[model samples]
Target: MDKQIIISIGREYGSGGHEIGRKIAKLLDIPFYDRNLLDEIADAKNVDAKKLEKYDEAPSRMFLSRTVRGFSNSPSVNIAEMQFDLLREKAAAGESFVIVGRCSEDLFKEVKGLFSVFILGDYETKLDRVMERRSLSAKEAALAIERHDRNRKAYHNHFCNGKWGDSRNYDMCINSSRLGVDGTVEYLKDYVDRFIKTL
Candidate 1:
């Protein structure tokens, strides 16, 4: 851990990406950013936290228009810009942290010692996890998963130069279902330890 390590995780809905990121941060003794990023942005930018939450990880309404001018001031777009700026500032200051989502992999491309990962689970596994976690019925969970994945894909594709969940965009692409949450965390911890040495 001699060098600053920034781990950016892209994940599918209910893939335990947030949990894995937090665990990795804890194991590595670094900061973890997820929904908490919105709070930081809200406080720093003097914006409403709740409003940012509403637009979090969602594509701009005019994303389909193919014209940046149309959605330049949109809440989603503005919030994304604010988040990116804050993250860039952190990176430029040599902060070592783990961040989940927010297209962080793309944000940190120029950063040294960045280990980007993407996690995806089988659809059935994701559905079951979502149902239990959200206390939703099977049908509701299925719809929620579809909606979230769709929105995340749209958001990432619109904001990033690379496609979401694509292996080529990340240093590693893991199927969390194969190793489960704890196992996946353990595996990533070891991989990150090795990654740090090469830095």
Candidate 2:
């Protein structure tokens, strides 16, 4: 594989995609970008990290919020744009990184050495995972999953041409529920290894 490969992961809620990306980055000894991307962008744009986080991976529904927050004139300077700027800067610098869940898989489609992976899980497994991770009851976990999945889908559809969680948009789609977290990471590592050989 090229030394400056970028791996972008798109994942459904409770799919363990972040963990998988982190593990893959660790295995490859590369930097990992997730919520940290938001922090960086928030700092760069002089925006509140909390507000950016509130709208992260969510479709914009806050024109008044932005105006009230003194972000009216520069409406285009949204979190997504800031995140994209950061991602573009890093890619232009020939950085190798694994990025998780930011509509990045679609955004970097034209970039060389960029691989997009989508992770999804069966509903039952996803609910279980969310419950465990968030210490929520089953019903609460299911609701959270549904809400997040809807937001993610809406965010991707609004921001990118492709539909979120659709296999056709990605280089590969894996069912983390079937392989489990560590196994999924191992599989992705091997897949990347093979992909590099082709390069």
Candidate 3:
């Protein structure tokens, strides 16, 4: 059997990365994991999905007093371990999936038959998408976007300890905002096809 292509996506804030994944999933008729994934993991583990939502697709650390951060007990390691366990179990199930964020690319590094994708876009395009989706004023949107990006960076770094958006870490990187969601999805479908043939 052909090994499943597990598309793990890392994206810039407001890059429409999530929507692109959803569209791709629908087109391929496969499952896509995002926030809803937190729900599944939570239920299976008897953990509160709501509590995980605090870190959902967002970073656990965006900004903190250096002093406070220094004092944080290493308790986060427990949560990290649980999430990692969940990721491994899911990957072993061998289902086609489009999984977003949580440093999934790094998490699945040793897993055979996986493809990692990174999605990004120009600042202005990302900002526009954020504004439209959140219905926030310019000032509000700008602040929120920056915050979200930082949070993801901090979150991914916390576990992966590598640079985000580094091309080598992913199989393909797309500018979804430039492709305008649907275009990006179609592009990814084509991209995945070529990738599958090579394997």
Candidate 2: list runs displaced more than 4 Å.
46-48, 62-77
What lDDT score is found at residue 39 in candidate 2? 81
8-94, model 3: which lDDT tens digit per residue?
889988888888888887787788887786687778879788877665544443244122543543334445556667777777887
TM-score list, all predictions: 0.94, 0.89, 0.85
lDDT of 2 by residue, 87-154 (tens): 88998988889999777887788876788999999999999889999999999998999898888887
The lDDT of each candidate is 0.91, 0.83, 0.76
What's the candidate order when arranged by decreasing lDDT?
1, 2, 3
lDDT of 1 by residue, 46-97 (tens): 9789877998888888743333655465778877878888989988988999
- Model 1, position 148, has a per-residue lDDT of 96
Better candidate by TM-score, 2 or 3: 2
Best by lDDT: 1
In model 1, which regions exceed 4 Å deviation? 63-71
Root-mean-square deviation of every model: 1.9, 3.3, 3.8
Error of 1 at 31 (Å): 0.5
User: Which RMSD does model 3 reach against the true structure?
Assistant: 3.8
> Which is the better candidate, 1 or 2, if ranked by lDDT?
1
